[model samples]
Target: MTKKLFWEDPYLSTFTSSVISVEENENWPGKFLVVLDETGFYPEGGGQPWDEGNIGDGYVSYVFIKDGVIYHVVDQDPGKGAIQKCRIDWDRRFDFMQQHLGQHILSSVFEKHHNAETVGFHLGTETVTIDLTMDSISDEELQKVELEANNQIYKNLKVQSLFPSVEGLKELPLRKQPTTDEDIRIIEIKDYDYSPCGGTHPAYTGEVGMVKVRKWEKVRGNIRIEFACGLRALKDFIWKNQQINSISALLSLKDVEAYEGTERIYRELRDLNKKYNQQSRLLLEYQVKEYHREAEEYQGISLVSLVFEDKDMKQLQTLAAALNQYPNTVALLAAKGDKAQVVFTRSKDLSLDISKLFKEVIGLIDGKGGGNPITAQGGGDNVANLQGLMDAAVIKLKHEYVK
Candidate 1:
């Protein structure tokens, strides 16, 4: 078995290690999995990502462990002969350490305080998450968790990792049982929490910087809380503050007053939208009056047809419905834009198949829609030929109904 140097000193970023073996990769040309006698790099496991750095003359792109041997997946093959210097990316290793420790602290708080069990965990590059065994956690409860987690950091409590015997583990008050009974590593936060974890961690809780629960969502009958800590939490806070400052300046309000100011503007926009809708309806009603006057008489029935530019579908419905007051009239209208929209409607007295007429005319522009015998609306790509399509429909209706 390879010596796990990281377990001895997680702070060691550089080391000298002899190559135990080098296996050439057939799938990835110019790549090799090199096994070392000892290593400081952490493998991707237990919700924490793998540590990245360089070994020998090539870049250490990946790291993994299999059958008690730690493999340094390198881009270039380092000949298996002598000792080589191994380097660990402290930024990445420490970040994961902070995040992993932060998760331990957070899950413990939720479990200890609210009796919520963390059933799932994922330590991502942008955010870390833990699925709590709860349907939902209220804002008030989450706030309390956040406050206490940060307080733990402020307390600067020592964090110890203990490897308890298989038989002795039964005595410890573990937050949760370990997956494997062989090697159970328990993390103890002094006067705070004791939980089983395989991932690395900082020496003290203060190194976690800050633990912030950003948001939560319901998933798999539980609440998944998305959070961040250390440098990631700092970055998030900086970005959010920048955005808030920009919004506050644009609203001509102080940082504290920005929310209320934005809410006021949003409410104003809603009122304006409602007022515009009312005025638009009145304008469409007047336009329908003008269209009714221009109707052509055929077989004692008025045929009102017109082509409008960029009119809404609702306007067409309202116009068609308003024109329906005329005893025996048919309304064939089109609104032109990138595409053409046509509406066909008749008064209650005329039991004509406007849907059939619409289907046929709409085919000229290759469009599809549907409605009953009295009213129908459709759209087509042939906007330029909208008037011609309406003329054809009107002529066909006249030939059929005209006496």
Candidate 2:
């Protein structure tokens, strides 16, 4: 069995060890696993990701434990039977340590205060999430849980990892039962929290630095609470303050009053949008009347063809519907924005399949969209040739219907 140096001292980031074996990893091609007689690289386990660092000159891409051995998968081979310098990424290792410890305190606090047992945990790169068996948690209750956990951190309690014999374990009051009967490693956070964990951790509660509960959501009858800890907590704090400062400056308000100022701005924008929409509708109504006056009749078919600047597809549909109100009328409208949109519609009295005709027209510009016969709409990159597209569609109509 390999010597578990990490369990011995996770703080030991750098060490020199003899490579016991070297084998090409079958799962990940081109990479090789250099097994050291002892290593401090914590392998991926217990909802915690693996540690990565340098194994000699090569990169320690991944680490995993199987059958009581630490396999350091390296990018470049560091031959067998050679003493190689191994260093764990201390920043990453310490970050995970902080998050892992934070999880324990948070979990213990929830159990003690609310009797909400943690069913799952994930120490993610961005956030650490703990899933509780409870179906729901109120805002007030969640705040209390967060307060309790941070208080634990503030207390700076001594955290101990003890290996107790099967007989000795019966006397300890563990917050949770150990899953494994043998080699039981118990992590006790002073008198506050006690649980079984094989993962690495800091020696004291203060080392966890701080913890913050960001948000929570319901998942399959469980509450998944997302949070950040240690460096992550500090990072989140910095980012939020920066954003608040920017908003406050733009709104000409104090930092604390930024929220109120933002809300006021939102209301003003809403009112402006409402007024803009009313004016646009009135304009479209006037435009439809002009179309009715200029409508051209061919073989008793009243055709209204027009194009507009920057009008959306919704406006095109509205204009088409207005023209269809008249008998035997066909509305062919196009709007130009980044692209050219063409809409074709006919009254129920007409026998035109605009969907098929629109499909053939859009092929000229390599564009895409479709609709049924009564109303068909599509757009293409032919912004400059909006008039040309209209002329082509009108010619196709004249060839089929107007002799």
Top candidate, metric lDDT: 2
Q: Candidate 2, residues 196-223: lDDT per residue as tens digits?
A: 9989999999999888999999999989
Per model, state how many residue pairs clash. 0, 0
Off by over 4 Å in 1: 15-37, 54-86, 134-140, 218-221, 282-286, 312-329, 345-382, 400-403
Model 1 scores a TM of: 0.81
How far in Å is the alpha carbon of 23 misplaced in model 2?
0.9
Report, for every candidate in turn, its global Cα lDDT versus the true structure: 0.87, 0.89
Cand. 2 Cα-lDDT: 0.89
**Candidate 2 residue pairs in backbone clash:** none
lDDT of 1 by residue, 1-403 (tens): 8888888888899999898888888865788989888999888788888889988878998888888778888987677876898889999999999999999999999998999999999998777899999988889988999998999999999998899887778878889999886767889899788888878899999999999989999998999999999999989999999999999999999999999999999999999999999998888778877788888888798898888886867777878889988889899888988778888999888877888888778888777898998898889887777878988998889986544
**Model 2 clash tally?**
0
List the candidate 2 regions with Cα displacement exceeding 4 Å.
Answer: 359-370, 381-385
Q: Lowest-lDDT window of 10 residues in candidate 2?
A: 394-403
What RMSD, rounded to one decimal, does every model reach?
A: 3.8, 2.1
Which residue pairs in candidate 1 collide?
none
